[model samples]
Target: MNADDAAADQLPLIDQEDRLMASLVPLAGCRLVEVGCGPARLLRQLLQQVDGLECAALEVDRVQLARNRSEPVCPGLHFIEASAAAMPLPDGWADGVLMLKSLHHVPLDELDTALDEVARVLRPGGWFYVSEPIYAGALNALIRLFNDEGVVRAAAQAALDRALARGRFTAVSEHRFAQAVAYPDFDSFEQRMMRPSFADHRLTPELIAAVRQRFEPHCGPQGARFVRPMHVRLLRRR
Candidate 1:
């Protein structure tokens, strides 16, 4: 399916962002803030579930912010165009903070300051949750092929560890979740792989094509399948 068709069919629901929001439903009554909320997909869902709850999303990309603004926003959902390191909200203003599929994009040098901002915005006893990809062994190879391996991997884990040591949060939980992606044919698989998000990496188009060709036969009747493993960490402010 083309990108537009896939989007229309809600195929995007299979991504990590959707899963993270589903996981956070238990924290329904709390006021929530999401950093790096690309397109505010999860933010919209959260607004739908929690009645009278306030939710704010901080997105750095002006283009994305403009698109989100053009969409019909829920009364409880608010969007702010800003960096994660400097949110406009007051300190300790949120009952929960979420960073999903976004920590990896943060620069390593500025990560500490960003985490501090997250901590500052979260209320005492509030929850801070982050879900990101961890590069382990072969996974590092795959990620490096597409993007900055060392920086993305290290920054994600560093943010987690640093948040754990902040003393403001307790009972930190770290776990991994996996999602499956299935492609119906080589054409579809190729299209998905070549998306701007994945293509900018170091992996050459030829290499990706070769890998896809070699693996296509083993993909079961579903055409092609790959497991995307995600790391999730949850912490409650003390």
Candidate 2:
């Protein structure tokens, strides 16, 4: 029950990459792996901002993986087609592992396996940084209309708690922050949110109208700006 756990609109809007870098002050020269990296946007930012770091971006989606590989490669950066539950990386290969808004997306039955895989790949005392979107706020409400994540998100947290309880990892830090997402219009929102390459929500005609009905009210002269509450947990592999 942290303060930012609530739908607090007043929370400072931050470039999450800045916060991530600040948290990962020791990241330079480290071997980092980002599991379930859809576009590796954050990884790209890190590769540019930090020096001497080797990063591997793992994605399970074929379409997104192909697109990532097709893109121009960054120095000290590579892409791997892999899943969080069963990473192809060798044991003790990573100095840090990241799961950004993707843990809850793992099959509920495989949540523990994914966490264990993270622990397996990470060296002793390596960092495990996980960021999950809180299941609250107007944006969550709109998204829930099509893809409700309440149960899976809770399960994700519970799995972490279980891992901590078992002494597989030690809690190093926790942070809560807000990131603002703006959609120029409903069309933009639909294109980005509803039609992602990962999961198929099966958007129907009636469903689209209903979603639009709820989303339109949030629009303004500047379009829709929604605060996405994010919870971050930094753990160390024991």
Candidate 3:
């Protein structure tokens, strides 16, 4: 990882203006949209740090959308429930778009359509920031025992590359970093990951035993600590 990559590894946890990628993102007084925004955690952080940020949080999961709607927030924030392949927003709707750790979650068949939607929603010269988890590392090894995402993740990267070649967007920058994933124990890992809001994971006995066997070696007095590799692509709307 380069200096910027190292700094961005702590992107979500702390408010490091320099490391938060404020320079690459749209400046103040711009509207932003986040596809698959989930709980709007990153949107909340960006709104607090960036000046005059109007964000549209989009999610395909109605459950997550409803949960976010119940929470109170400023009027500048809006929530929309929609799939990435078919966003409800109008053309040229936003100055910037974000898909953090969410693009790969889009259905594999619709990945290209989702990228097209991203390009459609962004105005000329607008920015799109996409961050995806690299399918490797100790944590991933444990998870692959039951739910493997190698194929989908590879397809997601291919879609991004194809977008660049299609001439709708220009790849301005790319960065790779690592984020720390700490679990108090195996139970915490299972609860948080296996039952994630988007997908259901069935952990058969054999799968459970495999995960336990692989995860046990990493367990320490405090817990298990693993670093997940991350790849980020910053594209400018052409």
Candidate 4:
């Protein structure tokens, strides 16, 4: 889906987190932390599911955090402004940690440190769950055609695999969720794709126009649709 459509049709806060939390049911009653929680959507929903289950979210961007302050805080929910590389919590404090759709922004060189931090904060037998996009098939070709520079989809998969191998966590489950988002029309699609956050590096007027042209033929009269594969994994500290 293009930016406006994405924003307008954004997943309902509770539904989105419920899907993620469903996979973590085994860890119910354990303290949970969410890293890189943008807009606090998932964090807000997570707080509703379990009573007295300590829930906290860490966001690196103060500006985003400030905007979230306008929203009422839920009971047992806490928001912290901090970097993922150096979580403020003491070691072995969290029984489960989550990072969803934010890993791509992390620099490749610092990935190890990020994983190290996740490993450090999690208690033995704790769970680390992550859900991220894994561009492949037609989507990979489309990204290459659009000259997207966010993350090499393949590299992201490889890095996560390597991190699991070297870090103290052991993989328990890996699943792929196919998400298809549709835009109302070309204009809507363009507006969404051109968001500063989505296309900060490689977005150009010419490239945007080209992408529109390339996907235009495929778009139904109503709008264009893009299918992207999302990767979800659950890991446990060994």
**Whole-model lDDT values for every prediction:** 0.69, 0.88, 0.82, 0.70
Give per-residue lDDT, candidate 1, residue 63: 68
Regions of candidate 4 where Cα sits further than 4 Å from its true position = 1-17, 137-152, 197-199
- Each candidate structure's TM-score, on Cα atoms with residue i matched to residue i, is 0.75, 0.94, 0.88, 0.78
3 or 4, greater by lDDT: 3
Please tell me which predicted candidate would have the highest lDDT against the true structure.
Answer: 2
Which window of 10 residues has the lowest lDDT sum in candidate 1?
Answer: 4-13
Query: Lowest lDDT 10-mer window, candidate 2?
Result: 1-10
Q: lDDT score, residue 155, model 3?
A: 90
- Predicted structure 4, TM vs. truth: 0.78
Clashing pairs in 4: 3-192
Stretches of candidate 2 above 4 Å error?
1-6
Top TM-score hit: 2
Clashing residue pair totals per candidate (backbone < 3 A): 2, 0, 0, 1
Tens-digit lDDT track for model 1 on 25-133? 4555678898988877777766766566788989887767788789975788888987878889998999988888788777777788888888899888788888775
Taking the tens digit of each residue's C-alpha lDDT, what string does model 4 give over 1-238?
Answer: 5553344333332225456557555545768888888776776666676556787788887767787676876777788987778899999999889888777656677677887888889989898888876545344445566555345545555667887888678898876555666778777655655553423546778877777777777677667666565677888887
Worst 10 contiguous positions by lDDT, candidate 4 = 6-15
